[model samples]
Target: MDYAKTERADALAAGYVAGTLRGPARRRFEALLPGHPALRAAVRDWQDRLMPLTASLPPVAPPPHVWAAVERQLWPTVAAAAPSPWWQRLAPWRALSGLALVAVVGLSVLLATPPPAQAPVVVVLQSTGKDPAVAGSLVASFSGDGRAVVARPITPVAVTTDRALELWWAPLEGKPTSLGLIRADGVTVLSRGRLPGGLRGSGIDHMAVSVEPPGGSPTGQPTGPVVFYGKLQL
Candidate 1:
């Protein structure tokens, strides 16, 4: 169904859910939701129905205390209903602490060690020469032989492209993975996304990209040519 009813407000309403409407359109929707229950319901319904198609996924189970936390969220007047203190009840803390300490050590090692300039993990994003393209260095790390990532977008490139630019991470190993697309604006904080199976620390030797269609490579693989490719030499 066409979401917009030719009404300015309805058009904004549709854009809010579809995520196509931004800035003023988004603000207008927020202002409209509470006063407009039908609009709210429409957005919620669209969210519930079309949400599966989007990138957001269901949550993994939180700790047992999470239910109490939810209670706190929904019913603030109610006290946290925990029979025992989590730290005392769970003996797993000792093991977890040990792991955490080991992680700290590993991270220290990583911080101290610099990546070789020739590493395969270093991938550059190449774009049309007409516009100043985003330069980035993708670093592949691993925990217990699983590929983890640390992508640092370099800003030195004098970006001058008219088309709104965004950065997407596509894994060379398995299915094209999303490292969250960048916003056209310079400072979009792309949250850490789910890691690919082969990328958990092994088999991830390189990274590639096809110019994504706007929000990203719509087909999940690069529909555009591999603008930039690199490998992990670390």
Candidate 2:
């Protein structure tokens, strides 16, 4: 196959960025990347497109037990030493608990504040195939203000290097409208300008994903099988 071809390089780069191109295929792609400027450019483009999605997501703090477990693994002698006095052990825990309490209170205050007129909508796109790599669901969340949407896969989807995944908004009566190309194994954020207006109305029915040639369907309609779909509930 001609890896230098724009479509071919883009498809391979998309799979690599999404983490679906793995094992020997992944290694080969990496080895070829340095020799192929087209492949490198494709990869850079994909990274720029997908990496920004993380900026909108809030960070999650790991639980206290996880840190304790890491400390035990790294410092066995200290961890295995005779248990510290009850007060000594409790002291550090107390401080952590206090900080957690403050955070909870702040979050509660935020949640108690008045919300936007439109509530956020969540849709779960179920896989049509039984293949283990594509069995899990994809979650699409529409912001309460209807200004943006974020879609994330629950598991990495195994797709060929010659294919890409395309997202669609399938209305109740009309044909599906292409949202954009999406990574099979990563988060995709669509701004309001990219989404069709009035998505919360009855005209909005389902969100779907279809396989397509790299760079998406050229005819402006799905050319391959629809692999995942879910009803949109507002």
Candidate 3:
């Protein structure tokens, strides 16, 4: 096939290596990998190219069972000719508690859980100054029954003027995605309907507050320094 289509196939190649390729696209790539050695090389090349982006990532050692699960998937049909790193055995999903649920109830389940309880306890994310003066304070609370979190900005934050703060939960080891932009009294409450399996109770390893751009970080990845990082405890 043509590896030079649509800007020289870099995007497609990235998606393929990232396992985001699906349906006919993935099937075509799989079939192509065996017969067209160059295509195989391209897949490997792309994976190698992006491997470092995730490196220097202060390794998030998966649970002991993670490697076993990985080997289970890999040992079935092994390839001896490849030269790949141990990390290559990893899948980004295994790192997220949502993976197990995604495999089971699927993404739709994120919307299916029951309603919140009546005894909700409020948790707030305050600005770095730790002054509690209410400039960039964001607040959220658990449903009285503790099924989900109601999160929202308490104020309007302009990155240039009022330091932008983003909220994140360690669904696993690292937190990705914005809970949403926050500021004092901006968004009264954001109801977290269902916490990913990873972030439930002590299940949540950690929670963080980041200083970000006005609208929030452009890249899905975090661009700002962590302002506050604390473990989730009972």
Candidate 4:
């Protein structure tokens, strides 16, 4: 009932929205929802904020290899000894060239199966330089779970000793939010909180890099020209 004023309630509502609250905690939350309007509203707010991300993802069927792996785990001996599907066991019918054709067909079936799901997204940030003389780029890759992102310079970026390169989350409909100061030539990991929530859902408008004073932007907003930018491909 006092969910609005408590950190614990907010966390529970978030976990519920994310579907990570399980078993007894989940049941308790559900039971509380009917008695506490504020708690129910809090859960609804989280759902509204996060559902689009989960909903937009298309369902992916597990690859054939996955089922094979499962079978091997459950019945290792049986899977290992399973007949070579009739085609691999075709040597007995060597006189018939038709057996070779059958083997080819079977092998084709196995090989033609679709590859596994794609890995997480990685964005390539290219120099926004208009002149050919300036060259710099960066690669931003999200963690496998999409909980964090890291940026690495692909081409060297030069910055003055008194300035730093800063990263920003350029949203679709608002001012860009500062991520943090990034290195000119090394890896820069953005904390999960700094990443735009939209990136996990619909997608971010873009990510940009700017040259700023050491320690970062003094205004909490970019004060320098955007030198490079790129969109996240989910």
Steric clashes per prediction: 12, 0, 13, 0
Consecutive 10-residue window with the lowest summed lDDT within model 4: 49-58
Residue-level lDDT for 187 in candidate 3 = 47
lDDT of 4: 0.71
Sorted by lDDT (best first), the order is 2, 4, 3, 1
Worst 10 residues of 1 by lDDT: 136-145
RMSD of 3: 19.4
lDDT of 2 at 181: 84
Comparison by lDDT, 2 against 4, better one: 2
**Model 1, runs deviating above 4 Å:** 1-150, 158-175, 183-189, 197-202
> Taking the tens digit of each residue's C-alpha lDDT, what string does model 4 give over 38-78?
78777876566545433544568886999999999999999
Estimate, for each residue in 1-234, the C-alpha lDDT of model 3 and write its tens digit: 576453235445545665556789888877766665556666676666445434443434466668756876788455344466544556775546545664678446657854332434344343555323323434454554455555555344334454566666655655454555545345434445445442444355555567677777788656776654433433
The whole-model C-alpha lDDT of candidate 3 against the native structure comes to 0.53
TM-score of predicted structure 3:
0.36
Candidate scoring better on lDDT of 1 and 4: 4
Model 2 Cα lDDT, one tens digit per residue, 86-110: 5556678796887788799979988
Model 1 Cα lDDT, one tens digit per residue, 113-227? 7643221122333333332254422222222223333333333333235322334434454655555554333434444434446343434455543345455655655555444
